[model samples]
Structures are given as structure tokens and as C-alpha cells.
Target: MVDYKTWMKELDDNTKLTQLAIPGTHNSAACHTALPSVQCQGESVTEQLKHGVRFFDIRVGKQFLKEGDDAKDLQVIHGKFPVKIPFPRLLKDVLKEFYDFIKDNKSETVLVSIKQEGTDDWNNDKDEFGNCIWDRYVDKQKDLWYLKSDLPKLGDARGKLVLFRRFGVKDDEKKQKFGFDAASWKYNTTEDDRGRFVVQDFCEIQNKDDISKKVKYVKDLAEKAQKSNDDKLFVNFTSGSNFFDHDCWPQQVADAMDKGGVEKVFAKGCGIIVLDYIEAHNWKLAKALIDKNF
Candidate 1:
């Protein structure tokens, strides 16, 4: 297994070293732009750049990489959060390549948000009591289908081979825990607007129920779905654990699907669910789902 812990430590150390080497990069404060009108309250501009915040700003220049194209269409995705990519051009260069592809294709701006282990944004560690704070966050955003803009950087590029080989393909839990974070919410909460994420809550999914057969059931369904399909199957239940009704079987259906080889399974609806445990045992699964299609 790739030591993500080591990698981040190196990256963090190197980034500091690079800043010292550059003699002004760290000294320069990013100019604050206007707050998003979307009505969502997320980490303030300060919070966005907190530990583990990898934002990439990809400018797709005009001109199609294909047979014919026009340069006039070239324009910035303009007026939104930039993509998040790890710093230090050398190690993070693969992300640059991905950004270039997005620009070449003239797709809308693609914001790439990446989270490294051992960052404040993702609580990879457990307290004395143990809990999956990150998984709870993933579960919290299950109801919304984020306006995901796929970037080529996330695709299987040449560099990815080496990175994955050395690092091993990332597990699913990380993706799930942070999938919604990568996405920009369409501000569609009001009557006058279409579906544009207006709110951004960086909280975890607090499972309302306790550890029971439901967790096992969800696992079973995901396992089954994984075996049966070449294309990954993703499902999120709208119901949650009910305290009064032990028969609620909140995740019973999802569990059934997992037993059938489903590639991904998640819970939806409004209610608390345990996030700490999910992070501890299956953070990899959560990450896989997020990275695959958040």
C-alpha cells in the first residue's frame, strides 16, 4: 500500500520548503473575491484552503483538439471556486495535464477538488471513543445529485499508471467521504432559480441509528453489485434507522444489493447515521465512490 501518510507529510514538508525556496509564494495572500451568491455557507475563503484543500484552476483555451474547432468559445468557467490540485508542480504535474485536457476540449470549467490524508478537512483519525466523522459528512449530502463536472485530470491518464501502481488505486471510502465536497452545489433552493447549488454544508452524516444488521446489510448489497456488473452500480437509500421501529431495516435493501455485487451503496433521506465507524472500517469504499463519480 502507498503510504499516503508519508506522501502528505512529504508534500506538506516540500510545499513549505518550496515556499522558502521561492521567497514570496507563501508571503503573498490570495486576494479575496466576492462571496458566492448561492446562499450556501461553507468553509470561508480561509477554510477552503485549510489543510487537504486541493483546488485546481483550469483555463480551457479555445480551439478544439479534434478535427475542427473555434477559438472564440474559449473562455474561463469564470466566477466560481477554482479546481483543487496538490501543490509542488513536479509531483502534482499530472493534474496539470488533466487541466489542459479540459481546456482543450472546451468543456465548461472543471473544478477538481482533491483531499489528501491527514488533513483537517477529512478526519482520518479517530478519537478515544472512535468515530467516522468523515463518513457522516458523505451520508449527509446523499440526497443531492451534485452538478458534477468531470475533468480529464481524474481520467486514466498515462501518469496515473505509475501513480496508482506506486500508490495503489485509491480505496472507496475516501471518495465517498469527500465526493460532495468536490462538487459545486447548484443554487436551486428558491422558487426563482433553476438547479444551482446554493448551499454548501461541510458536515458529516450523523447516522441516527446504532450499529446493527443494517450496516451489514448495506455491505452485502454492495458486494453483490460489485460482482455482477462491469459498469459500477451505485445506490443510495432514502430511509434511515428508526429508533422506535427495530424492524425499520433501514439498510436492508441496500445490503441485498451489495450481496449481489453492487459496486457502491449509500444511504439517503434525512436522519443521523454513524459516520465515525464508516470512516474507520470502510473509508476506502467511500473514497472510491466519490472519486469515481462525485
Candidate 2:
């Protein structure tokens, strides 16, 4: 087995990120929450990195303003609820952890899937949330990132923060593709041919019976990707929740999947398999997916 932290080093430089099977988390930073419905993962962002999770599905809530050049403090969120991590609420502080990880493990790359989260009625304008991310969080750490719209080879992307911008960008970049172009994805349910990505985020597990169907969806996509996986990115999510039922929360779903055998669900060319409670089943879930890359 390859070392979890530097697993990317084992892949050929000619390989595109889309071609590799990556371990990921649905809500990467919700490990600190006490709420049952919201807390998705058992590991922190940095800890997930050490466990061979390359793709991170991060949601940030825009907060109070600081007029100076300092990066805007963005709250880490899961739906309407706010989450607290070991670090401060500052997005910069959280991002600094990413930077530190990549700096130490230069052969690895972190795929950040960032989405704007919160219940604020206001929408994000060019100057506020978008500018805060592009100008402050991303631009400030320019050398540490890959802001291209298209997929990059493993060699070109090593030791970098590969951006998969889920939110919209500024005015000048409006016409062109920015980051991995995840701006338009099918919500809850997903299509098999979403151009840049093939996603299965069937998060509305209405009942216990739906969990198996969700697992089947993940398996079907994984099998499909293995057959004709080149070019398009496949994101299979093994996490779901129903707000009204405790039995259908993220933890329950994860438990069901583990009991149902998640190892068998993931196959070679599974793309990025996003899970909740990644540390479950003794980290075998993530290790199983990571083993597929070779």
C-alpha cells in the first residue's frame, strides 16, 4: 500500500486528475459540530489529507466585513447551520492549513470544491463573496493554486491547490471558464454526462429503502466510469440526509453503506468518491478507493 499522504507521487505525471480515483468528503470541515444532521465527517480537513482524501467539498458562509487588505472572514457551513473546526472561523486560517499540508507534501494536490453556503437572503455580488474568494483567499496565495478551467496533469498540479469553484466569479471572468467549471451541477440527483463531471449526489434519502438505491447509484456510476472514464470527472457521493428523520441522517447513511459493503461499491476509475464519516470501518472506505488508483 502507498503512503496515504503522498499517494499522488506514485501516479505518472502524464495522468490527468480526472483519470484518477480520488477519495473525497461531502462536507470536509463539519467534524466539529454537535448536531446530528450537520456533522458529516469524523476527520478534519488536514487529517483527511493524511488519509488520502484529495477532493474536498467545502461550503463557506460569508460574514462581517473588514475594509483592509486582510482576507474576509468566511464561516464554514453545512446548509443553514454554522460549524466550528479546531481552527478559527477565518477562511484564511483554514486555507493556511491546506497550504501547510501541500508545502510539506509537495507531491500531492488538494482539490477544493468550494460552494457559497448560508441562509442569508442576499445574493453574492462581484465585490462581496466572489471577490473575497478570488481576490483575497485565492489570489493572495497565488503561487499555491491552479486556477485553470481545464484539467491538469498530475505533474503540473503537484503541490498545488486545484480549484473547483462551485460559486460564480467576478465580471471579467464571467464569459470564460474558471477553475474546474463546477458552477452548474445537477442538485440532489445528477446526470451521467455532465460534461466536466458525472455526479451522483442523491442526498434526499427519504427512507431506509432509498439507501440501497443510493448505493446502487454509486456502484452504477463507478462501473460506468471504469468502462469509459477518461476526460469526464465522476463524483460519486455516499452521503445523504432527511431533515425530518434521524434514521436518514448522514451518520445513518454512512453506517448503512459500511454495513452494505462500500468496498464493493467503489471500483477502478470511480473518479472522486465523496463520503461521510470517512474514518468509518477503520478507514477501509477511503483506503479501498485509494487502492484503485494504481
Candidate 3:
């Protein structure tokens, strides 16, 4: 059995990060308690780290607005649905999972992508999504995260969570410096190359057969990512879904992909291939990506 907890301990520090394949979860937090359409993964963030997943695609929003009760407490969300821990969980609590995991396993680093999910109060001008996080959460525990807009060496970021900020504030300098400038991600794009990184998030799987198209695109992009210069990060999202065919949903899409075309591609480093429901396949694909690094 592969020991995932300290998988990066063997990796070279001089490697320019993009040279390795890092596996990730699409919606890193949504559990089974959420509505089927909203639920993506079956496990918590801690379990994902223990099982070899690295990057986390996270969505945050204000929780109590629809109840006529509102606060700035950011909670995890998958689309409009709140990720449930039986009830909505605070973002700090979800983040604690990352902190705790990194504390015990200092050799490993995790990448987190934070995006403003809903049209809640936090999205308004009064609050401004990015500044709220910077003020309330980031200011308090700045040491635990790597907040630079550029990628760092594995040695420099080993014990911290690398923040890939996808939320925006009014200040251009802050926005530019706020973790790799993914604030305006191009959706369904085959390749959104932003100099330091390239993102391929084709996430609307409209039909059942379209799964093959997504699979091929993910494979092609991941292979392309491997051929790129070491400084450029390739984020190929293999997960996609829509409201139509049940197979187009996260779990079914995951199952189909589990049996699809990733086996050969992952034998070598394939950049960051973001997935969905990683727990369903017993961490097979995630572990495969990690293995390629060595």
C-alpha cells in the first residue's frame, strides 16, 4: 500500500512545481448531506490529504442571508447549496483540516483555490469577497498560507497551504498580489494560459456521450502540460457536469472517468488534473498522479 501522508518527502526541492503532476478535488468539501446536484466529494478535506490529493477547489459564501439572518461568516458551498456537516460549516473549521494536516505532515504542501460562489452579502460592494477573507481570515493566520501571486519552490512551500485566490477586491495591487490572479477564470475553456499557469476547466458535461470529449480534452491538456516549460503550471480539470443526464452528474461522471483514459497519462507527470469524487475510486487516480512525481 502507498503511504500518501508524506508523498512529497521524496520530491526534489529544485523542481519548478509545474514539472510535477498534482491531483486535486473539484469541489473539495461538499458531502453526501448536500443535494445531489451540489454534492461532489464523499469525504472531508482531511481524508483527501491523507489519501494523496493536493489542490483543493473551494467555493465560499455567506450562510444565513436567506434566513433573514445574515453574517460575514464564510461557509463552504457547491454552487448555491451549502456543504453540510449535517448543517452548514464555517470556513475556518473547513480550513482547520488543511492546517492540521500540514502541521503533522510538513513535507507535503496543499494548493487551495478560493472562489466566491454565490450572490450573497459578501459579494456586494460593502463587503467585497476578497477583502473580507484578507481581513477576517488571512490577516489572523498569515503564516500558514503562501499568499504570493507566483509559484514558489517545493522547499519554500512545504509546510503551508498555497492560496490560489479567485476572489477580487477593488485594489489592483492587492488583486494582482492576491495569490496567482485567478479572480476571473475563463469557464469551459480548453486553455486559459495566464503566463505562470494554464487552466482548462471544461465543467459543463451536457450529454452522456460528451463525457468522452471531456476525457479526451483532459488527457490531451494534461499531456500538453507535461511538455510545457517547468515554470508554467497546467491545471487540467477532468471533472464536469450539468442538470441533464444523470451520468453527467459528479459521481457518475467520476465513475465513468475512473474507467476511462487516464491510466497511461498519469504514469508520467501530468500537471494538476483536478477531479471529482476521488474517494469513490479508493484514491486510485489521485495516488497515481502522486506516484508520477517520483
Clashing pairs in 3: none
Residue range with the least summed lDDT across 10 consecutive positions in model 1: 18-27
lDDT of 1 by residue, 181-282 (tens): 322222211111113111211112224332233344434433443343222212212123233443333233223223433233432211111121122123
lDDT of 2 at 294: 77
Residue 234 in candidate 2, Cα distance off native in Å? 0.5
As for TM-score, the candidate ahead, 2 or 3, is 3
Q: List the global CA lDDT of all models.
A: 0.24, 0.79, 0.80
Residue-by-residue lDDT tens digits, candidate 3, 160-244: 8889877666776776556666666588887788777788888888898888888888888888877765578788888888866
**After superposition, candidate 1 runs with Cα above 4 Å error:** 5-211, 235-294
**Model 2 regions more than 4 Å off:** 64-72, 85-88, 121-127, 170-178, 190-192
Question: Taking the tens digit of each residue's C-alpha lDDT, what string does model 2 give over 1-294?
Answer: 689878889889998887878889988888884455889988788888888889898888755343334324677788877676434355666688799999999999889988887745334564366666776678788799887888799899899999888876556564253477677666888444667778888888899999998888877887787787358888888889998898999999998888877678566676888889998867888888888887
Output the TM-score of candidate 3.
0.93
TM-scores vs. true structure, each candidate? 0.22, 0.91, 0.93
